[model samples]
Target chain A: MLRKADTSATWAIAFSTVFFFIGGLLTTVAPPMIDKTWSKPFENNDPSKGPTGKLVNYTPQQLKGRAIYVREGCWYCHTQQTRTLLSDTIRSGWKGVRSPVSTPDEFVYDYPHMFGTKRTGPDLSRVGGKYDTQWHRTHFRNPRDLVQGSIMPPFPWIVEDKEEFESLVAYIQTLGRAKNWRPDNDYEK
Target chain B: MPEQTSGRVALGAGGTVPAIEHCDTTAKWFMISSVSYFFIVGIIALTIAAKFCWPSLLGSVQYLTYGRLRPLHVNGMLFGWLLPADMALTFFIVPRLCAVKLYSEKLGVATAVLWNIIVLGAVVTLPLGMNQGLEYAELPMGLDILVVIAWLMFSYNIFATIFARKYEAMYVSLWYIMGTLVWTAFVYLTGNFAVLFATGTNQANLNWMYVHNAVGLIFTPVGLAIAYYYIPKSSNTPIYSHRLSMIGFWALAFVYVWTGAHHMIHGPISQWLQTISIAFSVMLLIPVWAAVYNFFATMKGQWHQLRESVPLKFLMSGVVFYLLTCFQGPMHSLRSVNAIVSKTDWIPGHAHMALLGAFSFFAIAGIYFTLPRLFQRKLFSEVLANWSYWFLMIGGLGFFVTLWLGGFWQGWQWNNPAIPFIDTVKALQPIWLVRFFSGVLMFAGIVSFVYNVMATILGQARDEAQTV
Candidate 1:
């Protein structure tokens, strides 16, 4: 293998491109394919068990609030994905229900995918409907007012802006209910 | 060959200096701009760090909210400071190694100007509540296009210069440089554009891919390339093993792209992708250590030079940090460890060591080495440089330790069924304050850096005027 003292730049570039491209395809490109393939069967056979087949589209107000969430960078401190681990599931699960493992279809409509990297605060996947609009209002206006020692900065400006405040509330309320747990809400009713 | 000679000759014939004949001015502009960004972004980071301990520091302003400020700090550092500094060194390195001029010096300068504008755009837009909400790829679609185009122009300029090179045997640094340019284009485009088409799990996959590759492919490779070039230069020796370098380069390029999905481990991403990410992350240790060993081994008899040469000191310590980062990276990707630290402050701690400790250290060292050549004078004060160096080293190390401990504490407390979330937040307050002060020290280091650089250039001008 070391016989040749000189390696071609062409060969080096070609080797890297091929492998990296394959890796990219395998991870980023291929997963969607896996989703498309597995999604239908999971939808038909195990709708109650696995993923909710279709994502519930956000209303106009919810979309506006979603935009506000993006604007505010809320995802930096709060993660939306409740992973399968006990630590994540236990905290993020709905009352008396184990947290459903987040599935591909649940995010079918999410463009930027807000499955955040950190959890400086708690996971927000099941935060929707857990608290009333008033709690969210008070909390956003000043986090430490409700939760002692919270490092989250006050969003009093948002509280004053009714549209943005309600919009963010609407968006927050759609988190876990976007797909899998909507059925649970329906079942409970 | 004739074209190369004719280009040089043509420049000599004209009274106006050939803009493409050398890279000094363009590289210097990038270096200066990069250093300025370093100081500016360091302050923004300090503000965010302060907000951690004192949430009301600027809590009244809508724009000064922690959410907005955090992204500004992150994007400002990534796009403004680190990337441009890498570009500056790349421009400087390419010409000297090839024994030829830059393909277009004006193009390089234009790219730097546009890049600064783009960074400024991020600074304004993020705070103005105009963001796309994806981490790392947070720039909105409009600005995302600008980034792609900038890189396109940059890649074109770089490749054209590589094509016009007078040297025959391609060095290892050239390979890394080319890899960075090409891979960044691929990563940036796919990360931003492909997400528009993808939804749900696919989007998550793509986003993490972009996020991880931004550091692993672009910053990591570029950083390694600088270390490869400078370590031997500063040590006054040839590389210990070319074979080892070759092994490192190939292994790194093949391994790193696959490792991005580790960010999505235990999440909704397919299990196989997680497995691929974990496997490759562990495999990454080989290339990482290989490069580290090569750097240290090259310093066999020259270990004493670390005391005298500031650049070598920075570069060697940067290598050690890189080694630690890579070690921590593979270990964290393990499912067990990932469970504990995946969403903790620990991730940011790991990131700081890589960005501040490894690459930014290399960038600082490169600036110290190149400024004299660009300005035709020695640094104005060795004391300031040493001071800045110690500040960065201590600040970086302290930040890493505090954040790692805080992350662990938060993760452990959160894992307990009985502990409320507020308890975890309260527990980390002291650590967060330490992080803020450490960040302030890092900010001070950048201030020293800017002052020293300006003085070095100004001192050269003064000396020339006196001689005249």
Candidate 2:
């Protein structure tokens, strides 16, 4: 039995294909300035001057942990950027200092922001002063011990070696440089 | 049994059979049992949501907290309700399409049973607040094992059937079904990696990847496969363009995975990654629009079928929603757009529009179209089917509007530093009321559909029954 291609189907295919290409093309071309405008002003916070300065640069092993994270798609989940705003700060327990008002210029040297989407896990944008290397290592080995309701899978393999564990901790420590220490007002209080 | 005998003869002659002999009565029974469980679970979720919209109706319990129960509601619909139906349809459709019997009925039934256990385990565990806290991936580790085993079993059965098929040119539906099964296996495994579980960072990326792919690679493809087959089969015409189907399929597969990051717009991830995600997400318009065009074009002159056939009603309505969902999805992915709507009801509105509106509707239509032919019975009542369609249609439309508008309102209000969150939620009270009412209508529609399906299967057949 011979079958003829329907005209309607042909046209549908042509139209949709054209639309897909156009949509893709439009994204590459800078969106109109008005379309890219933000409602709020960006804030600036520098982490290098904060307590996070206590741990700058990575050991080779920590670099490996970062490599593992990228290779295994860990960035798919944890975001390293925090908005300098109240709502996110409140939810993340970093309210007041780490608001959405924070601007990208604060991290002028940083390439591809690791700010993640979805809150399946807590934001890691301000990891510098939150926990110690041991906490980071133990949590990486088994998050359930730290948070009973954590849905995060265990990464025992990453922490199996002490050197690797230190490196991984070092990498995580580099995540949020700007808000590693509480503001002076809070400390004075 | 003349119809059965003719079907067998068609199979023997290698002629195109209107239907094939459905082996595995046990699998069918398991599917029915799962569907029943899903219906009950669906109603319970709807009731909970109803109470949430009107909190006075039910006092608070930790187990039924909005945070806990919302995930339950979503999981039940996706896993308990839709997954089983899609699996059953796969078992039925693949064999007929391939001119072969399922490789093993026992394996099929085992998969169904395990799937039910896994979903039930989630229902039991989640209410206790023992969840993984991941949206859609909320099932705890123990239950995740069961789901993984069930998926492996399904993958094996589907592959075995494909290998055993007699057909030379595999139909488009077969490609989609096979793709869904194979890709899901990889997608699920990667998304739920044992290594990344502790870092917590992996969870977000994995969850977004899994959730997005679950829609794009798994549910969307299966739903579209059914549409591709049923639309042409019902119209008694070959598809308009085989080449387009191939192109659309490849484009969709390539683009969808990269697009998941779009959900993370303005996220702390690298600017390059976000830009890439947005670009690919916008690019998705090609494959998606291609599908929409193909579907609409196929129905160009056969528009009358939409009026007469309940299956067509579901299918066409589903196609329309698919277009709407894709359009809205890319729009939401835009960074400026995400700044307003992220973490709000807007996301759920998109989800419902795609999952419930597009995929679920198409899945039901496929089941409705295939059930009678497989069972050798007339549909119990056209009237009940029509009523169910209208109920769901009206209810779904109402849900889309109210949620979309409510989401925008919430986004606008939350974005304003001057406006407080509590007052924004308060402002949404009326819209939430509409959502609850619409949900109730949808619940009624689901019950009606279940009733129609069950009665048709068990009820006495008419003397002059027409072939489905």
Candidate 3:
């Protein structure tokens, strides 16, 4: 069991790891480059005109709903970020909706960034104006009733729990509406 | 912490026990605790997989929803099951490798108990929405601090033991253990606390760095340490080449940390950063193959041991899965492949092949090989042990295959906007069901393993130390 104490071998591993680590960090060490049009809406009057208007901060109620969204793990299934691809923009919302790809400016205040990794359901990046409040209420209560093939779990608590339902819906409407809003499905067309 | 007849000598190296004389309390408890988490977190895994099939299975309970349960499952599996298992085996192997009793058996036991408390904290906090919203570092701040403290204690014990070693030259396994102790501390701290200071998408940088290195720096190295020690010891041979071992350890340490940004390939992270990460990820193949070659080469004359030796069987196949898992990691890092499958079920499939298939195999093999030595008793049932292996093999393979294929379909479907997103989710339902059943099979295998281990431990001790 007694091998040579090979302190050099030990030193090699420790130093090499430290060296490469510093090199690795050096690559990403800079603060992320801020986008040119981060929060600026395309049109001053219309946030949805293009990716030019300011990103709207959440109202107190929307903030409350964002908490519920996180608490319920909506981010696990419904992604918030739109990838830099045609399919992501088209699939996250229909082409007529003119959904912009998610940008860092829209998430300036996103503390624990809800830009989820997977699309277990759909990208919620442009879900803000896609459906009305009543539609969301119905969808949250029993998703299967609205969408035939949906696997989203029913949040019946939101239906019965007054404050929970309001906050969640408020947050849902703000998804892509604040800055990257698409007011109508036919806008881009 | 329980019953200890202090002065018993081990059945060393070949036909016998651990390579040293020390109290088994710390290592044994850590082993038992980790094994028990297999059932606890295995159930959690099954439940999570099941939710994909039946999303409303626990629809009403706020705590039991898929969202809360999912984080718990990951935390439980990583911290509760995998990390603890690695520590358990490390506690056992390092002392033997160092040719010294553990520096402080009492401290080891205390750390073991404290580690459990940290996991328990995860159980309570995560379900109640107390998570930090970080992936691997999800445990609340208090638990994170507790974990760091526990690691410091354990690392201190291991470092002291190595320092006290009477030998002039250290082994390859010792090199890995030492490297991981230093690397994990750096990775964990940077990922968890430092990210708080990063604003906007910048946090994603630290996040990926932390999570990827969590596997690369922490689990992979230590898992190799166990495999390196157990393969040679179980096969009753020296490593095929000390030089290869040297190349593998140094190369892996250098490459692994740089590859963290691979997770964000094609995403919003800087393009150059992604390219650099992917390059380093591919470079990882060199170290991975080096280790794999060494393991297989050591098994050259010992190939026949696969038939008669259950532990060797596990150790060897673990090597195979390690090869497959490592291969997939770099392939997925490629931008072309990453564009399609990075966000799909393929990611988890890649992960499971390593955690459940590769490392769990090594950890279990280590337990199977070392348990008898600790108590100086025979395995209660070889039939049961083999059953565990086959079950895990089938189930683990099934889990990876179904998810990999399913994830590809998902990526393709999403790529076609005409298909509609809901349809894509619907298309994956059948695959999710298959994954759920695979989860069932894996749970069964774990139960079989736990029972076999329990019976072996409780069975009568051998009368004579020289019997083997």
Candidate 3 residue-wise lDDT, A33-52, digit = tens: 44333223323554455555
* Residue A92 accuracy (lDDT) in model 3: 65
DockQ per model, Cα: 0.62, 0.06, 0.42
The reply for model 2, stretches above 4 Å from the true place, is A1-183, A187-189, B1-20, B24-27, B194-202, B460-468
Best of the candidates, lDDT: 1
lDDT string for model 3 (B1-468, tens) is 121223333224233334556787889999999988888888888988988888889888878888898889888988998888889899888888756788899999999999999988888988898867777877888888898899899888887887666453567888888887888888888888887776446677778788888888889999999999999999899899988987887778778888877776656555677888889899999999999999988988789989978889889999999999999999999988887897898878988999888998999999999888887778877777888998898999999999999999899887888887788888888999999898888888999999888878888433332242
Residue-level lDDT tens digits of model 2 in A80-123: 55553355555344444543323333333222234444332445
Tell me the tens digit of each residue's lDDT in model 2 across B1-468.
011222233223555645557685644755586458657876776865575355433333445544456667778888887877888778877887767888888888777778878877878887666654444666777887787888888878876776556554567677677667766765666555531432232234455666687788779878888889888877766787777787777677668777655665665334565787788889889988888888888888889877788998998899999999999888888877877777666766788889889998987887788778767778877777889999999998988888888888777776665564356656776887888899888888899888878877886555433433
TM-score on alpha carbons, each prediction: 0.92, 0.74, 0.91
Q: In model 2, state the lDDT of residue A184.
A: 51
Angstrom error of the Cα, residue B444, model 1: value is 1.4
DockQ of 1: 0.62
How far is B405's C-alpha from truth in model 2 (Å)? 1.0
